[model samples]
Target: MIASPDDVLDALDPEQRQVAEAVDGAVCVLAGAGTGKTRAITHRIAYGVLTGAMQPTQTLAVTFTARAAGEMRGRLRDLGVPGVQARTFHAAALRQLHYFWPKVFAGPPPQLVETKIALVRDAVQHCRLRADRTELRDITSEIEWSKATQTAPDDYPRALLEAGRKPPREAAEIAHVYAAYEKIKSGQGRMDFEDVLLLTIGLLDDRPEVREAVQAQYRHFTVDEYQDVNPLQQRLLDLWADRARSLCVVGDASQTIYSFTGATPAYLLGFRRRHPGARLVELVRDYRSTPQVVGLANRLLAHATGEAAKHRLELISQRGEGPDPRFVEHSDEQAEAESTAKQIRKLIDDGVRPAEIAVLFRTNSQSESYEQALADQSVAYLLKGAERFFERPEVRQAMGFLRAHAISSGSDPEPAHLPAEVRAVLGNTGWSAEPPAGSGQAREKWESVAALLRLAEEFAVKWPDATLRDFTVELAERANAQHAPTVEGVTLASLHAAKGLEWDAVFLVGLNEGMMPIAYADTAAKIEEERRLLYVGVTRAREHLTLSWALSRTPGGRGRNPSRFLDGLRGTGSARPDAFRSPGAGRGPDGTVRPRRKVGPVRCRVCAKALQDAAERKIGRCLDCPSDVDAYLFEQLHQWRLERATEHSQPAFVIFTDATLTAIAEVRPLNERQLAAIPGVSRTKLERFGDDVLALCAGHELAIESDPDEFEGVPEPEIVPDGA
Candidate 1:
């Protein structure tokens, strides 16, 4: 039996009780992260059914994703309220379209295309334009955005300018592609996911009978994730509640991360203006995370600007205190990944299940190193909301496409525009110099193509005459070697994919300046959205949270700074001497630290000029300085380092970072005193390799081979927890 109104109301928090009690007319629930919005809304529906205010069959609950809709249905069932319809906007609209198609104009509903990729690809071919897989996805997204906003193909260009949309391609080009896509879709007697919503709206608008039936059938309406409702969804909702505006919407503008999909928080924010008597309730009591996590989330939003942040709710944690979020700075991307994997292993060993942990990043491209690092540590991991790089359809297709082009070229001399030629060949699959402007699948696809292009560039640089055929072979080898995703393991996901989900622990990796706010987050509005994105990541953790960034992308690359969003968040203290816990942290021999000292900018030892590059800082010299590096000594050190790395089964850089190796070669350390003076040559490393290194510098070889087992019993570095 359904719970009574009093019984339902008694179970809700004060604000949630207000949300459940205001069961008539229009209502708006300003729910913050971790708040019990789901509980409040489900109880409201049950209370209404129990009090004879609404019928079960007539109530409809709509959300963004199928998983969310299913969750809502499950929650409603647990509340003793069954028979109420719960579905995603697409599912509900598709069902209504099928039911009303015969009544309106068609013999039967047009066959719905499962995905827009094929159709969009066909449209690109029809328009005689070149697009790679990424471009095709971007075009598909643009069409969806256009249809959701009710903008016609002819007006897409103006719409883009008006809305400040930076599409992957030119607005005019996208419009042509959009127009061609519609024509082809119509010619094949097929409709897309977006068309389902558009056609349903058309049926309701054109046929009053159909509109009345739907409106009368669904009298009480509730919307979840209302902040993510696009114009098309709002139109459908309006049609469903035409005369009787018995509606309830739950959303947090702070969680609005789908603007790329044309979703807007305007409707949720303006609900009071639309319905003057709408009951407004603010659910600030967060039931998911502890006070520490909640406080960080609130602080993240406090720095946010723009309209969405204007109405941000300050979440109060209902749970007890938890560990403060930690921030770690690493030497490079590889170090960051390894450190993250080690921590995940520690968490699992400490009783946290693998599935209870997640590692989130800004882009899918960053997942590779983490995947490798986790595997290296023997920790299982699953890719959430993404596919393994090699297994992606776009990547597989591009490989085939490139191989075909390479065969067709057949013995031609190297073209001067090798990079351009490679781009042209991949353009058929959507390769471009610039990346996609939007997030999600389009961005992920673009990153994949960009990686291929980067490989081609590197190959061309290495062998000036290397042909397309050679590059294809290299790619095949990589694809064959790429690891398959794990079935059940630690979750690796993009921040966008982590929404509506929580974990016992979360590691937010790759928080560098160009990434978190993203390099293309040019405008103030977009930057604010990036801040909100970080906020979303922060709130996903229920207990343990660690945020980290690397100083460089590769072993030998120049330094990169942490994200500005973390300016006031990370700890500022003297560097720790520990090296084993995190390999390249602090002023130890293994890595350099950004210490708080009275020293001026590092100067070149030779020129006495200020040195800016990280590599130069490590060597204490400018790049243009006269040659002090011994070529033979450097080669010997490199060989020795490689052998050590092989013996240890670790990356060469892990044994000695590129900068450290270069510094050693330049200094040509003769003994313990000289070797100890070099940066990145830790005491432990001196004890381990000092004698061998000195002998090599003194032109002696093939002596004193040490066993790898001799290095056993060395303590691993502890993952230092940080506080602001």
Candidate 2:
């Protein structure tokens, strides 16, 4: 049955209704996470079609992901408005490009480049520049960054320098490779993903007829996640509208965490500037998380500083009270992981389904320990963004080959020759000692197969009586279980993948300083993005939220500190119950009160000067006043120096002497211009580490001012580099 317009309007709350009913001209809906932004936009399309203000075929609903687009289409279908076009920006643009290619370009469009990294590797070889994996990753990142910023290859170096970004390799080298990459791609009659949007925009802008046709066909446009729209996307959006202002965009600036991808909230933040008469609506009511969770999210954002932070919408929680967020500290990463798995088990025992519990971490690498811990406890768990061990294609294929071999043999193979048998099986199945040329996926698949062989070797050693048949049976059972979609298991996911997802109980693991903000998040903007990511994780809890960290990776190692983000949450006005106490509450067997672990700013080991930079604190000394240098900071500087050495493929200390870092730390220059004045701080170093050095010093200073008592007993050291 076709639902009436009233039926569509009735589904939304007051704020959403206001947005859904606004069917004309430019409308911008600032929808927060879990605010039913999807419902608002879907309902808006339905209302438009029902009210004769928009035809389903004339409206284009653009989303960022295919999953989101499918959901939008499904919701529109449910609303009796199935014909509305809902697709990703790429999908929409690709469709138009495909349709108009022969007419506009007078030939078939170039094939889309599916494997960019391979092409980039070729570009590097063509440019005669040697690059390692890290450098290659960074160069590709630079290319993406350049494309996202709408900077052409010829202009990349200037734009990169102006932005004060330190490329992993020489800017000129990267630029040369970028230009070569473009040339090679063009020569091969191919286009990368970014070229789709760029080409579509160019076609629309240069050809009036094409623009008019598109504008005429899609007269009304609705964009989801507008805050993440890059400049290229924004230009395409503008061209699609053809200056008619029949565009509605929905996004939450606070959720704008894709800056790394060249997505800026600038477009969303400046929407009103472009359309002064645009109707604005804010969806602040959050229906996903509990009030406690909502309060925590609000507190987290209260510390954010950016354009997105400036326009932050405080979410009004729609649900009743739930458990206060918990903070737990552990002795090390292993203890943290084991304890987390235990907590999941406890939550499951307490009536919460295993599927309703999640263990979220900052990075994908952090999942390994947790997976092991869960497996040790025999807890069934799914790694959300990772392929299951038994489900990997390589693993499955190897298992199939093993099973067939075992069946053909009609007997158990001797454990002594199992290693050879496994190798022979893999070799027969086209496995190679070296990765195939220009195919990363093939290399990864080979690695997966190699891993399975290693597992088999280990299994053979662990169980001397085991046969190939035994291993095959075990593998079959595991694969079947792992491949089941609805298996009852806890979820382990990275924070990035946890966005737009919620759970009844969430354990946010690995909240340590270097892990949370990450060692590489060295700038204010990067830090803010990290904060937003944490906020997204915090808001994913419906009933319970547990924030946790560990002191170190192992026992008796240098202690890792909790994230600075925790300080903001602790200082917030919100009141909540604590489930765990900070470490160092009691003494050893002597029954004495343990000396309180120094909980304050780091002091330079040399002069005992308080060091604010967490890295500096870790190093335990200042650069010049090496009496008490922050060892970690020194190590980090050394590592960065080594990376620079590798970029030139030269020896370390040749790029920049240790004394140079000392001078930099002593001078504590606040910017590249200032840093360049110091001796040994060469033009290359200035270009490479200038922004990083300044950020480090600034972070330390801020930390000191925020909590001076932590620096008690430490004398204030003068900031003066040797030459300065």
Candidate 3:
């Protein structure tokens, strides 16, 4: 009555067709980037539904990211398979946990505790942990593992030791702090993300009712990026697969880069041996990248060591010949950033969209100089996986104030109360956000408060008789407390966070040593992992990819070397990569010679911290010059400035910034009170620094308080003190 499954073969290429049509047994599609593996899976789901072999609700499709899930959903809908369930592993698990938690527990489920580095910091302080200035992220990762594997704090040291996770050689102290952390978390009544999956797996394993229900519900299961299934996710997937033979999967062992999160390709490699009758499919078509890029990818794979290199699948380049991959060397960070930005500008001038170009880096910290260089060049860019968005100074302050007020007033019965007050105050002061969109978990409780407030405004507009108090009262009642905004624009993601994502144009910036392979990659294994990370970044670009590294830190910090990966490619002048070096780079537009600038070290005048190469001089007397140039911005920015050519006295930015001085010269705040009212001028500082600021605003010379620190190394700052 229905055509054979081979009918689906019409849309896929030979390799893809086989993988897509192999519905009778376990299927494994091992392929390289752009080989249409994702497309084949999507089509296979569509065909199964169309052939009446699989119901939309019975099959499970998994992706690695929320973005990928959305994309898969759209693709399935386009192919007339709307009901197929497609989601990220974590997202799906969280959903199931929320649904089943109450039913199984017989009462309201224990709330997920939101773990923070604050807990680690408290531990560090409480336990007097004097680590070598370890970062919050590293600590968080350790805690993440402890919870993911369901190890109680009492058992963590033994469990982590067994799991090969080394930290703080002092187990007793770590145990003490970990115990304190648990006590604190129990008081808070929330759980970190890993615990959610672990809990889900527990419920499934401990309760047959829940396990059988889920197993029966998901008749078939498909997982993408199978190499990255963490232990908890693997456990859940195993349960689902226990009763159903319809487990189809796709992944390349070479792309297994998340070992830190406890994800390994061992399951993928062991798939066929474990399931003897599995229908294994291998697709080698390199459909996404040009031959040159593919060649480089292949070379890297060939050079790769360890498990991934050993299991590397051959990539058959199917795309046409493209530009060569380039290697650019820099003497320092500044030169590298400037050089890269200049090249991007040239590409833009030649009709490349800014969005089509991306600059990737090995870590988030590396983005600073490149972000500055791009900012210097007026290039708009997006950062990925950074808590930076939430860390905005203003947002932090507002949230802090709201959270404080909420705690004082009591957050129960409404977490929305304080945030609403803060937002109302901010909006009145000219912040125009209308809350985040979507019905995500956060929106359910708090974020919708803003939305409700918005609706209240609309209702008021329709019913003009309603007053502000009326709307405010109604808004509070409907307030949904915790909404994370649906942020848009370009993404600036970390190399690890950038996994499973594709972009039009990508920039991999900050390829410097200590940042890329990072300082710890001194080990052979870590170094190889770093190489795989770079390969991962390279593969993310659909059209354009820019890889760059800086030789030194920009003036404020100690200098670092250009990443070892970029060492040999360093040219003498301008440091432009030669043709055949990279597919996205290489030749400049219009056949013009891209200058290769030789880089030299430039040390900061203040702390002696190096700022890129010597040729990249400070922007007209170190923007950070400690000279009391009250008229200038970023007072501390002029740390290591040298060779001052002018004598102009004014207070530092605290006394009055150059921009404020310019505004003062233009708008001219005439008196003490008026100066106090100006933005950034605190009442205490305005009273104390009043005469000095007022005199400058009125274009008059005035005396200022002297500081011992102002002229630390130099005795000549008296030549022209700022706001004097």
Best by lDDT: 1
lDDT of 2 at 533: 88
Off by over 4 Å in 3: 1-8, 115-137, 150-155, 158-171, 183-190, 387-492, 503-513, 543-724
Q: Clash number for model 1?
A: 11
| lDDT measured at residue 482 in model 2 versus the true structure, 0 to 100 | 37
Q: Which stretches of candidate 1 lie over 4 Å from their true place?
A: 1-3, 393-443, 449-485, 572-581, 584-586, 589-724
RMSD of each: 10.9, 22.7, 17.9
Q: Write the per-residue lDDT of candidate 3 for residues 1-724, one digit (tens) a residue.
A: 2234445557788888877766656887787777888788988887788877788898889977888888889988877778888998878888888889889876755676565667667666776765322333445556666665556778977876665555534556666667776667667666667766777888888999999999888888888988877766777788777887487889988887777667778888888887788888887887777666665566656667887778787777776666556565443454565567667756766877766666776554444445444433434556666544234344344344444544464424433333345456556533456422221122222322333333433333323333333334333221211111222324556777877767656667777776667654545766777878877887776655556653334322244565665543345222336333212222257863333222233333344453321111222123354533443212222321111101111113323333434333322456654453333343334533466555543432222224435434322221111121
* Model with the higher TM-score, candidate 1 or 2: 1
- Using TM-score as the measure, what is the rank order of every candidate, best first? 1, 2, 3
lDDT, candidate 2, 1-724, per-residue tens = 4479998888789999999889999999998888989989889989999999998899999999999999999988888988999999999999999999899778999999876888899999998878655357667878988887899878987986676566666778888999999999999999989999989988898888999899888889999999899888888988898655378999988887777668889888899998989999999999998888888889889889977799999999898888778777776565677677767766876899878999998766566566655543445677987676665656777888998987786453234366667788889988866543321234445556765665566445433344566567545533443343435678989888887788999999889897789766777888898999888888888888888887665433466789998986753455342434323432356843333232333355457675433234323466555353344345666777677655533445444555557645554556665566554454434544577777776776566679888755443434443222
**Candidate 2 accuracy as lDDT:** 0.74
TM-score on alpha carbons, each prediction: 0.74, 0.68, 0.63
